[model samples]
Target: KYSQMPRSVGGLNAAGEWYVLRSMIPGLKDKKVLDLGCGFGWHCRYAREQGAQFVVGVDISARMLERARATTHDTAIEYRQQAIEDIDFADGSFDVVISSLALHYVAAYEVVCRKVFRCLAAGGTFVLSVEHPVFTALAAQDWYYDEQGQRLHWPVDNYQQETLRQTRFLDTDVVKYHRTVATLLNTLMDAGFRITTIAEPQPTAEVIAAYPEMKDETRRPIFLLVAAVKPV
Candidate 1:
Protein backbone atom coordinates (compact mmCIF):
# COMPACT_ATOMS: atom_id res chain seq x y z
CA LYS A 1 0.00 0.00 0.00
CA TYR A 2 2.87 2.33 0.80
CA SER A 3 4.41 1.76 -2.62
CA GLN A 4 1.03 2.12 -4.29
CA MET A 5 0.63 5.63 -2.95
CA PRO A 6 0.34 8.37 -5.60
CA ARG A 7 4.00 9.16 -6.15
CA SER A 8 6.20 10.13 -9.10
CA VAL A 9 3.19 11.07 -11.17
CA GLY A 10 3.24 14.72 -12.20
CA GLY A 11 6.19 15.19 -9.80
CA LEU A 12 4.17 14.49 -6.67
CA ASN A 13 4.91 11.96 -3.94
CA ALA A 14 2.98 10.93 -0.88
CA ALA A 15 2.06 13.94 1.22
CA GLY A 16 3.40 16.16 -1.58
CA GLU A 17 7.01 15.43 -0.64
CA TRP A 18 8.62 14.83 -4.04
CA TYR A 19 6.82 17.87 -5.36
CA VAL A 20 9.31 19.96 -3.40
CA LEU A 21 12.08 17.47 -2.85
CA ARG A 22 12.74 17.00 -6.56
CA SER A 23 13.46 20.65 -7.08
CA MET A 24 16.11 20.56 -4.35
CA ILE A 25 18.23 18.10 -6.30
CA PRO A 26 21.30 19.31 -8.15
CA GLY A 27 22.42 17.96 -11.50
CA LEU A 28 23.23 14.26 -11.75
CA LYS A 29 25.20 14.06 -15.01
CA ASP A 30 28.08 11.63 -14.63
CA LYS A 31 27.64 11.69 -10.86
CA LYS A 32 27.82 8.64 -8.64
CA VAL A 33 24.66 8.58 -6.55
CA LEU A 34 23.51 6.76 -3.45
CA ASP A 35 19.87 6.39 -2.47
CA LEU A 36 19.07 5.37 1.09
CA GLY A 37 15.84 3.49 1.72
CA CYS A 38 15.36 3.27 -2.03
CA GLY A 39 12.05 1.47 -2.09
CA PHE A 40 11.25 0.06 -5.54
CA GLY A 41 14.31 1.94 -6.94
CA TRP A 42 12.32 4.93 -8.09
CA HIS A 43 15.05 7.44 -7.38
CA CYS A 44 17.75 5.08 -8.54
CA ARG A 45 16.15 4.74 -11.92
CA TYR A 46 15.64 8.47 -12.06
CA ALA A 47 19.31 9.05 -11.37
CA ARG A 48 20.34 6.76 -14.19
CA GLU A 49 17.96 8.47 -16.58
CA GLN A 50 19.58 11.75 -15.65
CA GLY A 51 22.96 10.39 -16.77
CA ALA A 52 24.40 9.40 -13.42
CA GLN A 53 27.58 7.38 -13.82
CA PHE A 54 26.38 4.80 -11.35
CA VAL A 55 23.65 4.47 -8.74
CA VAL A 56 23.44 2.35 -5.64
CA GLY A 57 20.11 1.85 -3.90
CA VAL A 58 20.16 0.58 -0.33
CA ASP A 59 17.21 -0.74 1.62
CA ILE A 60 16.99 -3.14 4.56
CA SER A 61 13.99 -5.05 3.30
CA ALA A 62 14.85 -8.06 1.14
CA ARG A 63 11.40 -7.94 -0.35
CA MET A 64 11.86 -4.32 -1.28
CA LEU A 65 15.21 -5.08 -2.87
CA GLU A 66 13.68 -7.88 -4.88
CA ARG A 67 10.99 -5.60 -6.19
CA ALA A 68 13.55 -2.90 -6.97
CA ARG A 69 15.73 -5.33 -8.90
CA ALA A 70 12.79 -6.65 -10.87
CA THR A 71 11.78 -3.20 -12.03
CA THR A 72 15.34 -2.04 -12.74
CA HIS A 73 17.06 -3.18 -15.93
CA ASP A 74 20.08 -0.93 -15.97
CA THR A 75 23.53 -2.39 -15.56
CA ALA A 76 24.85 0.77 -13.91
CA ILE A 77 22.31 0.58 -11.10
CA GLU A 78 22.80 -1.78 -8.15
CA TYR A 79 20.45 -2.57 -5.31
CA ARG A 80 21.75 -3.65 -1.90
CA GLN A 81 19.84 -5.12 0.98
CA GLN A 82 21.19 -3.25 3.97
CA ALA A 83 20.00 -0.92 6.66
CA ILE A 84 20.87 2.74 6.22
CA GLU A 85 22.46 2.79 9.68
CA ASP A 86 24.96 0.07 8.78
CA ILE A 87 26.01 1.49 5.42
CA ASP A 88 29.79 1.83 5.16
CA PHE A 89 31.29 3.19 1.99
CA ALA A 90 34.74 4.64 1.35
CA ASP A 91 35.13 8.32 2.08
CA GLY A 92 34.06 10.49 -0.87
CA SER A 93 32.25 7.60 -2.50
CA PHE A 94 29.26 9.41 -3.97
CA ASP A 95 28.58 12.65 -5.74
CA VAL A 96 25.00 12.78 -4.47
CA VAL A 97 22.98 11.12 -1.72
CA ILE A 98 19.21 11.09 -1.52
CA SER A 99 16.81 9.57 0.98
CA SER A 100 13.04 9.79 0.79
CA LEU A 101 10.81 9.40 3.79
CA ALA A 102 13.30 7.19 5.58
CA LEU A 103 15.25 9.00 8.29
CA HIS A 104 12.41 9.01 10.83
CA TYR A 105 12.75 5.27 11.12
CA VAL A 106 16.39 5.61 12.07
CA ALA A 107 17.03 5.86 15.80
CA ALA A 108 20.50 7.34 15.24
CA TYR A 109 19.93 10.00 12.60
CA GLU A 110 23.09 11.73 13.76
CA VAL A 111 25.15 8.66 13.01
CA VAL A 112 23.62 8.32 9.55
CA CYS A 113 24.17 12.00 8.87
CA ARG A 114 27.82 11.61 9.75
CA LYS A 115 28.06 8.56 7.57
CA VAL A 116 26.43 10.38 4.66
CA PHE A 117 28.75 13.30 5.14
CA ARG A 118 31.78 11.05 5.05
CA CYS A 119 30.73 9.18 1.94
CA LEU A 120 29.67 12.21 -0.09
CA ALA A 121 32.34 13.78 -2.24
CA ALA A 122 33.29 17.36 -1.65
CA GLY A 123 30.81 19.71 -3.36
CA GLY A 124 28.30 16.88 -3.48
CA THR A 125 24.66 17.40 -2.61
CA PHE A 126 22.54 15.60 -0.04
CA VAL A 127 18.77 15.75 -0.26
CA LEU A 128 16.38 13.94 2.06
CA SER A 129 12.72 13.81 3.03
CA VAL A 130 11.40 12.42 6.28
CA GLU A 131 8.24 12.45 8.33
CA HIS A 132 7.91 15.93 9.78
CA PRO A 133 8.52 16.22 13.51
CA VAL A 134 5.11 17.79 14.02
CA PHE A 135 3.44 14.76 12.52
CA THR A 136 5.47 12.35 14.60
CA ALA A 137 5.61 14.23 17.91
CA LEU A 138 2.32 12.73 19.06
CA ALA A 139 1.87 9.02 19.51
CA ALA A 140 -1.32 8.95 17.53
CA GLN A 141 0.36 10.36 14.38
CA ASP A 142 -2.95 11.76 13.32
CA TRP A 143 -5.24 14.74 13.59
CA TYR A 144 -7.94 15.49 16.15
CA TYR A 145 -11.20 14.17 14.76
CA ASP A 146 -14.73 15.16 15.70
CA GLU A 147 -17.31 12.63 16.73
CA GLN A 148 -18.60 12.62 13.19
CA GLY A 149 -15.14 11.66 11.86
CA GLN A 150 -14.19 15.08 10.63
CA ARG A 151 -10.60 16.15 11.21
CA LEU A 152 -10.56 19.31 13.26
CA HIS A 153 -6.90 20.06 13.84
CA TRP A 154 -3.59 18.34 13.84
CA PRO A 155 -2.38 17.49 17.33
CA VAL A 156 1.19 18.05 18.31
CA ASP A 157 2.59 17.24 21.76
CA ASN A 158 5.95 16.98 23.47
CA TYR A 159 7.76 18.16 20.37
CA GLN A 160 10.95 18.72 22.30
CA GLN A 161 10.98 15.21 23.66
CA GLU A 162 12.88 13.18 21.09
CA THR A 163 12.25 9.46 21.33
CA LEU A 164 10.95 6.42 19.57
CA ARG A 165 7.30 6.63 18.61
CA GLN A 166 5.17 3.61 17.84
CA THR A 167 2.38 4.19 15.36
CA ARG A 168 0.22 2.28 12.93
CA PHE A 169 0.77 2.43 9.17
CA LEU A 170 -0.62 0.16 6.47
CA ASP A 171 -2.16 -1.90 9.25
CA THR A 172 1.25 -2.62 10.76
CA ASP A 173 2.87 -1.40 13.94
CA VAL A 174 5.78 0.86 13.04
CA VAL A 175 8.42 2.55 15.14
CA LYS A 176 9.77 5.97 14.20
CA TYR A 177 12.10 8.38 15.93
CA HIS A 178 10.97 11.93 16.55
CA ARG A 179 13.20 15.02 16.58
CA THR A 180 12.42 18.70 16.51
CA VAL A 181 13.06 20.77 13.41
CA ALA A 182 16.00 22.36 15.15
CA THR A 183 17.45 18.99 16.05
CA LEU A 184 17.05 17.73 12.51
CA LEU A 185 18.83 20.73 11.03
CA ASN A 186 21.48 20.78 13.74
CA THR A 187 22.19 17.09 13.30
CA LEU A 188 22.98 17.66 9.65
CA MET A 189 25.05 20.75 10.34
CA ASP A 190 26.90 18.96 13.11
CA ALA A 191 27.85 16.31 10.57
CA GLY A 192 29.78 18.94 8.54
CA PHE A 193 27.14 19.48 5.88
CA ARG A 194 26.38 23.07 4.99
CA ILE A 195 22.68 23.78 5.30
CA THR A 196 21.41 24.70 1.88
CA THR A 197 17.62 24.50 1.97
CA ILE A 198 14.80 23.15 4.10
CA ALA A 199 11.15 22.74 3.18
CA GLU A 200 7.92 21.87 4.95
CA PRO A 201 5.96 20.96 1.86
CA GLN A 202 2.29 21.71 1.40
CA PRO A 203 0.04 20.51 -1.35
CA THR A 204 -0.48 22.72 -4.37
CA ALA A 205 -3.94 24.06 -5.07
CA GLU A 206 -4.12 21.75 -8.02
CA VAL A 207 -3.16 18.81 -5.86
CA ILE A 208 -5.74 19.67 -3.22
CA ALA A 209 -8.28 20.00 -5.96
CA ALA A 210 -7.33 16.59 -7.29
CA TYR A 211 -7.37 14.95 -3.90
CA PRO A 212 -9.70 16.66 -1.52
CA GLU A 213 -8.36 14.70 1.46
CA MET A 214 -5.07 16.55 1.13
CA LYS A 215 -6.77 19.85 1.86
CA ASP A 216 -6.13 19.48 5.58
CA GLU A 217 -2.39 19.35 4.95
CA THR A 218 -2.30 23.13 5.20
CA ARG A 219 -2.82 22.81 8.94
CA ARG A 220 0.52 21.01 9.48
CA PRO A 221 3.52 19.76 7.61
CA ILE A 222 3.52 16.07 6.99
CA PHE A 223 7.02 15.80 5.56
CA LEU A 224 10.32 17.65 5.95
CA LEU A 225 12.68 18.03 3.02
CA VAL A 226 16.25 19.13 3.61
CA ALA A 227 19.11 19.84 1.23
CA ALA A 228 22.72 20.16 2.30
CA VAL A 229 26.08 20.21 0.62
CA LYS A 230 29.51 18.92 1.55
CA PRO A 231 31.89 21.82 0.98
CA VAL A 232 34.44 21.57 -1.75
Candidate 2:
Protein backbone atom coordinates (compact mmCIF):
# COMPACT_ATOMS: atom_id res chain seq x y z
CA LYS A 1 0.00 0.00 0.00
CA TYR A 2 2.94 2.35 0.66
CA SER A 3 4.98 1.52 -2.46
CA GLN A 4 4.96 4.99 -4.01
CA MET A 5 5.03 7.18 -0.91
CA PRO A 6 7.90 9.57 -0.21
CA ARG A 7 10.86 8.31 1.81
CA SER A 8 11.22 9.94 5.19
CA VAL A 9 13.33 9.07 8.23
CA GLY A 10 10.89 6.36 9.31
CA GLY A 11 9.56 5.00 6.00
CA LEU A 12 6.99 5.68 3.35
CA ASN A 13 3.23 5.73 3.97
CA ALA A 14 0.16 7.22 2.41
CA ALA A 15 -0.40 10.97 3.17
CA GLY A 16 3.24 11.38 4.26
CA GLU A 17 2.18 10.58 7.83
CA TRP A 18 5.56 9.05 8.49
CA TYR A 19 7.03 12.52 8.63
CA VAL A 20 4.59 13.43 11.38
CA LEU A 21 5.48 10.32 13.35
CA ARG A 22 9.20 10.90 12.76
CA SER A 23 8.94 14.38 14.20
CA MET A 24 7.91 12.90 17.55
CA ILE A 25 11.06 10.77 17.78
CA PRO A 26 13.67 12.01 20.23
CA GLY A 27 17.36 12.33 19.40
CA LEU A 28 18.97 9.02 18.35
CA LYS A 29 22.62 9.90 18.95
CA ASP A 30 24.22 7.29 21.21
CA LYS A 31 20.82 5.80 21.98
CA LYS A 32 20.02 2.10 21.89
CA VAL A 33 16.74 1.65 20.03
CA LEU A 34 14.24 -1.13 19.38
CA ASP A 35 11.53 -1.18 16.76
CA LEU A 36 8.59 -3.55 17.26
CA GLY A 37 6.88 -4.64 14.05
CA CYS A 38 9.81 -3.07 12.24
CA GLY A 39 8.54 -4.10 8.82
CA PHE A 40 11.41 -3.37 6.37
CA GLY A 41 13.73 -1.81 9.01
CA TRP A 42 13.45 1.64 7.55
CA HIS A 43 13.42 3.21 11.01
CA CYS A 44 16.28 1.02 12.15
CA ARG A 45 18.46 2.25 9.29
CA TYR A 46 17.39 5.78 9.96
CA ALA A 47 18.44 5.48 13.59
CA ARG A 48 21.85 4.15 12.57
CA GLU A 49 22.30 7.13 10.26
CA GLN A 50 21.47 9.41 13.20
CA GLY A 51 24.30 7.78 15.22
CA ALA A 52 22.41 5.32 17.38
CA GLN A 53 24.72 3.10 19.41
CA PHE A 54 22.74 0.03 18.39
CA VAL A 55 19.37 -0.82 16.85
CA VAL A 56 17.19 -3.91 16.68
CA GLY A 57 14.27 -4.38 14.30
CA VAL A 58 11.68 -7.05 15.08
CA ASP A 59 8.88 -8.22 12.82
CA ILE A 60 6.63 -11.27 12.68
CA SER A 61 7.03 -11.66 8.93
CA ALA A 62 10.09 -13.60 7.79
CA ARG A 63 9.68 -12.15 4.33
CA MET A 64 9.88 -8.63 5.71
CA LEU A 65 13.02 -9.43 7.68
CA GLU A 66 14.57 -10.98 4.59
CA ARG A 67 14.07 -7.79 2.65
CA ALA A 68 15.20 -5.69 5.57
CA ARG A 69 18.41 -7.66 5.94
CA ALA A 70 19.02 -7.53 2.23
CA THR A 71 18.68 -3.75 2.13
CA THR A 72 20.54 -3.00 5.36
CA HIS A 73 24.34 -3.09 5.35
CA ASP A 74 25.09 -1.37 8.65
CA THR A 75 26.74 -3.52 11.31
CA ALA A 76 25.01 -1.56 14.06
CA ILE A 77 21.59 -2.80 12.95
CA GLU A 78 20.08 -6.27 13.54
CA TYR A 79 16.80 -7.75 12.35
CA ARG A 80 14.86 -10.40 14.24
CA GLN A 81 11.74 -12.36 13.38
CA GLN A 82 9.48 -11.99 16.39
CA ALA A 83 5.85 -11.22 16.99
CA ILE A 84 5.18 -7.94 18.79
CA GLU A 85 3.08 -9.70 21.42
CA ASP A 86 5.98 -12.04 22.25
CA ILE A 87 8.76 -9.42 22.23
CA ASP A 88 11.30 -9.84 24.99
CA PHE A 89 14.29 -7.75 25.97
CA ALA A 90 16.39 -7.40 29.09
CA ASP A 91 15.40 -4.67 31.49
CA GLY A 92 16.85 -1.32 30.48
CA SER A 93 18.04 -2.78 27.20
CA PHE A 94 16.90 0.08 25.02
CA ASP A 95 16.73 3.83 25.27
CA VAL A 96 13.80 4.07 22.86
CA VAL A 97 11.09 1.88 21.31
CA ILE A 98 8.84 2.60 18.36
CA SER A 99 6.01 0.87 16.57
CA SER A 100 4.08 2.03 13.55
CA LEU A 101 0.68 0.70 12.58
CA ALA A 102 1.34 -2.54 14.44
CA LEU A 103 -0.27 -2.60 17.88
CA HIS A 104 -3.80 -2.89 16.56
CA TYR A 105 -3.00 -6.35 15.27
CA VAL A 106 -2.24 -7.69 18.74
CA ALA A 107 -5.07 -8.80 21.02
CA ALA A 108 -3.17 -8.18 24.25
CA TYR A 109 -2.02 -4.61 24.07
CA GLU A 110 -1.70 -4.25 27.82
CA VAL A 111 0.71 -7.15 27.99
CA VAL A 112 2.84 -5.64 25.26
CA CYS A 113 2.76 -2.27 27.01
CA ARG A 114 4.11 -3.81 30.19
CA LYS A 115 6.85 -5.60 28.32
CA VAL A 116 7.83 -2.41 26.55
CA PHE A 117 8.00 -0.65 29.91
CA ARG A 118 10.25 -3.35 31.33
CA CYS A 119 12.56 -3.35 28.31
CA LEU A 120 13.10 0.38 28.19
CA ALA A 121 15.72 2.26 30.16
CA ALA A 122 14.82 4.90 32.73
CA GLY A 123 13.24 7.87 30.98
CA GLY A 124 13.07 5.92 27.75
CA THR A 125 10.44 6.93 25.24
CA PHE A 126 7.87 4.79 23.47
CA VAL A 127 6.35 6.23 20.34
CA LEU A 128 3.71 4.41 18.35
CA SER A 129 0.88 4.86 15.86
CA VAL A 130 -2.28 2.94 15.10
CA GLU A 131 -5.46 3.18 13.09
CA HIS A 132 -7.78 5.56 14.87
CA PRO A 133 -10.59 3.85 16.78
CA VAL A 134 -13.09 5.94 14.84
CA PHE A 135 -11.77 4.49 11.62
CA THR A 136 -11.70 0.92 12.83
CA ALA A 137 -15.05 0.90 14.59
CA LEU A 138 -16.93 1.31 11.36
CA ALA A 139 -18.18 -1.84 9.68
CA ALA A 140 -15.83 -2.94 6.90
CA GLN A 141 -14.07 0.38 7.47
CA ASP A 142 -16.22 1.67 4.69
CA TRP A 143 -17.28 5.22 3.91
CA TYR A 144 -20.69 6.28 2.74
CA TYR A 145 -20.63 6.90 -0.99
CA ASP A 146 -23.02 8.77 -3.27
CA GLU A 147 -24.27 7.44 -6.58
CA GLN A 148 -21.38 9.15 -8.34
CA GLY A 149 -18.85 7.24 -6.16
CA GLN A 150 -18.04 10.34 -4.15
CA ARG A 151 -17.48 9.92 -0.44
CA LEU A 152 -20.38 11.41 1.51
CA HIS A 153 -19.70 10.61 5.14
CA TRP A 154 -17.40 8.65 7.36
CA PRO A 155 -19.63 6.48 9.52
CA VAL A 156 -18.53 5.62 13.03
CA ASP A 157 -20.41 2.99 15.02
CA ASN A 158 -19.63 0.82 18.01
CA TYR A 159 -17.52 3.61 19.43
CA GLN A 160 -17.72 1.94 22.79
CA GLN A 161 -17.34 -1.61 21.58
CA GLU A 162 -13.83 -3.00 21.66
CA THR A 163 -13.49 -6.07 19.53
CA LEU A 164 -11.81 -7.65 16.55
CA ARG A 165 -12.57 -6.22 13.13
CA GLN A 166 -11.84 -7.67 9.72
CA THR A 167 -10.98 -5.26 6.95
CA ARG A 168 -9.60 -5.76 3.48
CA PHE A 169 -6.42 -4.01 2.48
CA LEU A 170 -3.79 -4.63 -0.19
CA ASP A 171 -6.07 -7.32 -1.66
CA THR A 172 -6.10 -9.26 1.60
CA ASP A 173 -8.39 -9.52 4.56
CA VAL A 174 -6.61 -8.58 7.79
CA VAL A 175 -7.74 -8.73 11.39
CA LYS A 176 -7.36 -5.73 13.68
CA TYR A 177 -8.43 -5.15 17.25
CA HIS A 178 -10.46 -2.08 17.95
CA ARG A 179 -10.07 -0.32 21.30
CA THR A 180 -11.54 2.86 22.57
CA VAL A 181 -9.31 5.90 23.15
CA ALA A 182 -9.81 5.54 26.87
CA THR A 183 -8.58 1.97 26.80
CA LEU A 184 -5.45 2.93 24.93
CA LEU A 185 -4.62 5.85 27.21
CA ASN A 186 -5.40 3.93 30.36
CA THR A 187 -3.35 0.96 29.26
CA LEU A 188 -0.22 3.10 29.18
CA MET A 189 -0.99 4.61 32.55
CA ASP A 190 -1.69 1.20 34.05
CA ALA A 191 1.69 0.07 32.73
CA GLY A 192 3.37 2.97 34.58
CA PHE A 193 4.16 5.15 31.59
CA ARG A 194 3.80 8.89 31.66
CA ILE A 195 1.73 10.12 28.77
CA THR A 196 3.59 12.77 26.80
CA THR A 197 1.87 13.49 23.49
CA ILE A 198 -1.10 12.31 21.45
CA ALA A 199 -1.80 13.37 17.89
CA GLU A 200 -4.40 12.79 15.19
CA PRO A 201 -2.36 13.74 12.17
CA GLN A 202 -3.82 15.09 8.94
CA PRO A 203 -2.25 15.66 5.58
CA THR A 204 -0.66 19.03 5.23
CA ALA A 205 -1.89 21.43 2.57
CA GLU A 206 1.29 20.95 0.59
CA VAL A 207 0.78 17.23 0.62
CA ILE A 208 -2.85 17.54 -0.45
CA ALA A 209 -1.88 19.87 -3.27
CA ALA A 210 0.67 17.36 -4.51
CA TYR A 211 -1.74 14.46 -4.21
CA PRO A 212 -5.24 15.72 -4.63
CA GLU A 213 -6.73 12.36 -3.79
CA MET A 214 -5.32 12.70 -0.28
CA LYS A 215 -7.45 15.77 0.41
CA ASP A 216 -10.05 13.55 2.05
CA GLU A 217 -7.48 12.82 4.74
CA THR A 218 -8.23 16.21 6.19
CA ARG A 219 -11.84 15.18 6.71
CA ARG A 220 -10.96 12.60 9.33
CA PRO A 221 -7.82 11.24 10.94
CA ILE A 222 -6.79 7.81 9.80
CA PHE A 223 -4.06 7.27 12.39
CA LEU A 224 -3.31 8.26 15.98
CA LEU A 225 0.19 8.80 17.33
CA VAL A 226 1.07 8.42 21.00
CA ALA A 227 4.27 9.18 22.87
CA ALA A 228 5.00 8.17 26.44
CA VAL A 229 8.03 8.01 28.71
CA LYS A 230 9.24 5.78 31.50
CA PRO A 231 9.84 7.80 34.62
CA VAL A 232 13.41 8.17 35.80
Put down candidate 1 lDDT per residue, 1-232, tens digits, no spaces: 6665566333234446567887999989999999999988889998998899999999998988898899899999999999899999999999999999989999879999999999999999999999999899998998899999988899889898999998998778999999999999999999999999999989888778877878888888898999999999
lDDT of candidate 1 vs native?
Answer: 0.89
lDDT tens per residue, model 2, 88-198? 789999999999888999999999999999999999999999999988997588788999998998988888989898888656789999999899989999999999999
Candidate 2 TM-score versus the reference: 0.94
In order of appearance, the predictions have TM-scores of 0.95, 0.94
Residue 201 miss distance in model 2 (angstroms): 0.6
- Give model 1's TM-score versus the native structure: 0.95
What ranges in model 1 sit over 4 Å off? 8-15
Over 4 Å off, model 2: 1-10, 13-15
Best candidate, TM-score? 1
Best by lDDT: 1
